[model samples]
Target: MAGRLRVVGVRVERVSGRVAVVVSLGYDGAVVTGRADRATGETQTIQVAAEAVLEAIRQVAPGQTRWGLEQVAIQPMLGGPAVVAHILLEAEGTSEHLIGSALGRSGPLEEAAAEAVLDAVERRLGWFTKN
Candidate 1:
């Protein structure tokens, strides 16, 4: 929140054996991947640094109050650098029901996931650019 509000598209993908939420951060708007679990029509997203995505988790799973960051990476994007924060969940039975409601339904999971993450960031840091 110290800097200007950065907007980058987000993409979420469930690959071979990992669930990743890619985002474009301050660095280069890189892909910030995180592990996810989908079951019973519910999705639970876990990431390192509970504070980073605490808002999203809580929003989806009100009971979720803890998390940790698995990996943090920064990659290059088209115009600017991308920042990717790979997070790890603490529990195994995490839910995925909060996907649509919490994360926006405009794009992929990564984008929605990014919205969730940013939602927390804005709450903690305050709106980057207020109208």
Candidate 2:
């Protein structure tokens, strides 16, 4: 586990009291689910891809600069109108090295994982690009 906390992207849907639901979009197209305890500030996230790890990084980068890769696309749900919802996660008890260790291979895996998380975030958050 490294000193710096690792930032991962999780589709935070609902937060009631001390509990919240977070879903991680893996690079292999898998949904890793978890329960976050706000009171204790502990997140027991499921096993996700390197992309998810990158998403976490983007969430808490150094400055205004765009973290990870550009062009995050989040598609809306079909056949229904959904209200925009955002879940703010306080990153603690996790680091990049810790996440990287779980992600297996470094370099490309990290980049791809980041991209995947961003895509999920964009879709979940309804982020759109101006053409």
Candidate 3:
């Protein structure tokens, strides 16, 4: 097994109802980012986005991990409604980065983003397990 993965930072941004999330890991300088569109325009978009991001992190690096969320940013975007997410991850002990993205509504967007991020990380680290 490799060394444990740690989350060093997190950022959540919201514009008008769309959300963008970034998760940074300490090992190998990995960073994962995602976005979502809220159909209900709920006020808890940040929390939701954070959950999605964390879930993504959990999927990629599953055992004996540390979470060090550092930052979160939220704002309004002046544009139409759209949902999209992207992630750039560098697994520990490796130099190459894994990138992924997803597009859809809020619920699907979250799942898609998480899947994309995890898929990239798993491809490199093979640390995740089904749950």
Candidate that would win on lDDT: 3
lDDT (Cα, tens digit) per residue for candidate 1, span 7-55: 3434445656544443344423333222333332333332322223443
lDDT of 2 by residue, 27-88 (tens): 22333333333432443222123224444444434333242322222223353221221223
Arrange candidates, best lDDT first. Answer: 3, 1, 2
- TM-score per candidate: 0.33, 0.22, 0.32
Worst 10 residues of 1 by lDDT: 95-104
RMSD of 2: 14.8
For each of the candidates, give the backbone clash count: 28, 10, 3
The alpha-carbon RMSD values of the candidates against the true structure, listed in the order shown, are: 12.8, 14.8, 11.6
Q: For candidate 2, give the lDDT.
A: 0.31
Which scores better on TM-score, 1 or 3?
1
In candidate 2, stretches whose alpha carbon ends up further than 4 angstroms from where it belongs are 1-16, 28-78, 85-131
As a whole number from 0 to 100, the lDDT of residue 6 in candidate 2 is 22
Across 1-131, the per-residue lDDT of candidate 3 in tens digits comes to: 24444444545566665666655544345545433335446534544554456554654555554322222223223442233333343334434544433333444333443433434454445443333
